[model samples]
Target chain A: MHELAPPLTLEQGLRWLDLIGILAFAMSGALLGVRKRFDLFGVVVLGCVTAVGGGAIRDTLTGQTPPLFLRDETYLWMALLGAGLGFALGEGLARFERTLSVFDTVGLALFAASGAVGAINFGLGPLGVVFAGMLSGVGGGIVRDLIANEVPEVMYRRDQLYATAAAAGALVVVLLHPHVTSFQAQLGGALTIVALRWLSRRGWVSLPVRRVPGARD
Target chain B: MHELAPPLTLEQGLRWLDLIGILAFAMSGALLGVRKRFDLFGVVVLGCVTAVGGGAIRDTLTGQTPPLFLRDETYLWMALLGAGLGFALGEGLARFERTLSVFDTVGLALFAASGAVGAINFGLGPLGVVFAGMLSGVGGGIVRDLIANEVPEVMYRRDQLYATAAAAGALVVVLLHPHVTSFQAQLGGALTIVALRWLSRRGWVSLPVRRVPGARD
Candidate 1:
């Protein structure tokens, strides 16, 4: 059994984490737009879309109205701030890619956990909850890549675990939900995903793949 | 002025049109999956997602729960049938691409009109309504291309008016909403989109494209 933080403190911590995730995702999207040489409007649009895409998808799936970002304009403002930073910094931000990756992982883990929780609250079944969780973690990145005309890294990057990590994390949340507080379950799930990603990066784990007969080289 | 059909007749007609659209979209998506050499499961998933994607997006945006397809299993059955046909026929279906395209256009127009009406019912502004409509028409196609790892044709196909036509059709719906019945407005909107698409295909209309400075070839 795990001890729970006070409700107010837990909520505040989650809010800050969410904001951090939003800012990181927005910057990542804006930087990609810059590299793609999209016009200024396109860059900002990509940033905002990436930041809010996952949450919006989760909310829409669960019948939440108007989406959380629309309800809370602060999220949009943060996305704009991150996008502006990315556009202004341009190539200067490239050097910090490693640091950004860490934040990206953080965002992914939290999103997967929160999405699973939301689906559970909405009475989704196990498979639905797991799928929702994975979608929430990676949907923004997928949208960013789509807009930039690139294959989504999560779909094709089989060398290291990404979506698999998210799925595992969501499964963790689902398994723990019945036995623990929601906050505890969420934290445990996030930690599990982060750990899985770290392990996969070091070649400690990997998913299997099979080449199809007669497929192109 | 226009003569209005009885409500029951209009509803049934709309239902049939919806099913036709779903079938065309599912076949198109499945055909693409086949061309890409995806597994049977992947092909079926692509087909179903393409068939249901637009209306799901529209319903979610308008705060509708479970979406229409989830509520009505007939749509899923139609999508499955279309996918099965595409898979069984394989490359042979390519010869009928022109016929499929016609049905695709019909689907696009009707979806755009219905999306605009949905947005209007949800009390969205004109811009939001128009956006909703265009997304409804093209959203499925975009998703299909994204999963297939290609640039969305609608985004780069400037030689023809696709999304623009949907937006214009939606504008028509918005403009006529206060002056006519919903059904009539939707019919007018869909017809306008179909006409625009047909005209554009004949080289009579096109959107402009500009090359950015220092961009890659």
Candidate 2:
């Protein structure tokens, strides 16, 4: 890896993808709030938390106190918009789980890339950055599962390529760092993750988790 | 500060108080679960979290990974017992908020002292230890309030004396660390917190927010 680097260019792309991804995540959170019959205020809070909870935690752990919600209201507004739309379209949205899944996947990809980017920006080494990226991308989902009183899907024996995609994307960023503008690398990383996850979903790709002969349990 | 001497009697007294205090705190956590209308499983989880969440977080920040819950089942069982009693005797205990508060104060005192001790054990000085103590005592309550969706009582400008009690107790321990066994100092600290918090609840102790003449608005 080169010791010096050029300027990062993924700013606009990252922001747009981040927004889309967060909005999708927020919609999912809103649906849960609706199912719980929470008040509108609760729905908004829950939606925003679902969108950003994990990243917020990762940032805090890295010493970004009080965190992004205190720094910007953009994400909150985006989540609010998504949740508001979701509340109005709750029944209609259920029929389009396929469409929602696509959006969720896009969000996952963008977040995975950006999570790594954010961690690297904070000067974390490769391992820490990769961990932070995965944490940021999947943390909200885990929190949602916990509150919903279900074990987090990512922790189950067969996950839907959620955390794995994030880790892969993060690894890509780590490898490409110092060799490319952060933007090109992030976009490439995001697309790679989405493609991999999409392929996994379509049964075109699968992990070889089964033990080989004589392997210890 | 005498750097070499120790107090044997104070150490023994402290040991007894710490044990009983832990039991009391764990019991209170179980009772909280019952009030939340939790099932047996929910009750146990809530109780254990209430008993240890703050301490665990504090330990994490202090660079102690994995935390005590990963190592011990004492809190879990205690919480289970508390929750069971609370669930079974819930209706009859509605009028016991006052009693709960008193018990909570005792737990708070112990928790505060323990937090201080833990921080000190982890190499923090007086200031950090005092802060840790205060956080440990009220951290679980804050988490409980967040989940319950109420404004945390500790954040309000009330004369609750919760954190204040913890800080006072921690200060006592810090000041007397050398002359007393770690146990004695901790006991003194816990008693100090309990006394202050209980007195405040009964309208006996209150702070006036000591202000300087030129203090900024």
Candidate 3:
């Protein structure tokens, strides 16, 4: 399986990035579950699903079945461990919202890079690569929100810059792949996403909203 | 690949069942999108996703890549047609709620049977088979509800016999698989689900709700 292949330098870096991202996302999911007053089992389920759901979606779409998580137990264990920590810490962790966002940003950047690389390896074009990357970044949060019976934050939240940042990062990877070493390309893509997301958050940047020509403001 | 296998008697029967199910589910999803006031693209997207989401999830879990839908265009076309009909018909289709329910029932029964059989083929244990079957039956609806930002009916509605009926039907498939012909087992299992779901609807059968002893009256 591609996921189990011996890692090159670039792949190794991406794998490490994925490990940290999965743990952060898992903890965020567990926190959401606790706030929603779910049972312990529910919390764990949410955590694991949130961490893996996006990658699973990407894999399924690209015809990579059983996903990376099922192939390797490490991802599952990390998600579970993160969920346990979230649950144990409870309300106290809520105070560290900023820290959680930073983790989320890191996860988003890494996942976007990996997803784009995977799509390219599968021989997809630029559009497909960008889409795969963006979906991988946001798919987990969407599933989490759906399970919680809320609108997906990424879909309508113009101010979030979640999908956009991923797309931008993936585009950079696609553009740079032909010229640079794979490691440089991957690192550049991920760093671009993190930087864009951080800047957007700091500046409260948002997409413009439009109203119908005849409608009142 | 399992999905690419030439059709046997049982597979042929299941294929017919799936065609009907996909169209019906697609219509339901499109109608939901219309009610939510989504654009035309959104309606079609929802319809296609709802029809295929469950099977995709099952395939991913079982290590079946590129999913059946992606492998064939027939399913995609049917979903698009269904969505178009739903959009054009608008509120008129709402008058046929009973007809739609019947279609949904047939789809649920067929999906449950196929899912169980697929699981068995993959060497999953009985519990895994049942879970897969049930998930295939309900996965589409869960995804649809999530996109629409509504609580998933199967998760929260005790009054619905959806998942219960699927589980019972899948259990029958597992129990009978070893002793009977594949066609016989699949047909019998599907019939049981359709019968139970029909009866539940006619009789207004529902699971009972409970409260904590000293918490709420």
Candidate 2 lDDT score relative to the true structure:
0.70
Best of the two (2, 3) by lDDT: 3
Better-scoring candidate (TM-score), 2 or 3: 3
Off by over 4 Å in 3: A1-56, A60-134, A137-149, A153-217, B1-10, B84-92, B156-160, B211-217
Model 3 residue A183 distance off true place after TM-score fit, in angstroms: 15
Model 3 alpha-carbon miss at residue B190, Å? 1.0
> Poorest 10 consecutive residues of model 3 chain A by lDDT?
A208-217
User: For residues A186-206, what per-residue lDDT tens digits would candidate 1 score against the true structure?
Assistant: 999899999999999999999
Expressed between 0 and 1, the share of native interface contacts present in candidate 1 is 0.21
Question: What tens digits encode model 3's per-residue C-alpha lDDT throughout B80-109?
Answer: 788777766665678877898888888899
By DockQ, rank the candidates, best first: 3, 1, 2
The CA-based lDDT of model 3 is what?
0.82
| Residue lDDT tens for model 3, A79-154 | 9998888888877778988888899999999998888888878777676677678779878987888888776666
In order, candidate lDDTs are: 0.85, 0.70, 0.82
What's the candidate order when arranged by decreasing lDDT? 1, 3, 2
Score residue A104 of candidate 1 by CA lDDT. Answer: 85
**What are the RMSDs of all candidates, in order?**
8.3, 13.1, 8.7
Cα lDDT of model 1 by residue, B103-163, tens digit: 9999999999999998888777676677679878988887888788776666556567777
Considering only N, C-alpha and C atoms within 3 Å, which residue pairs clash in candidate 1? Answer: none
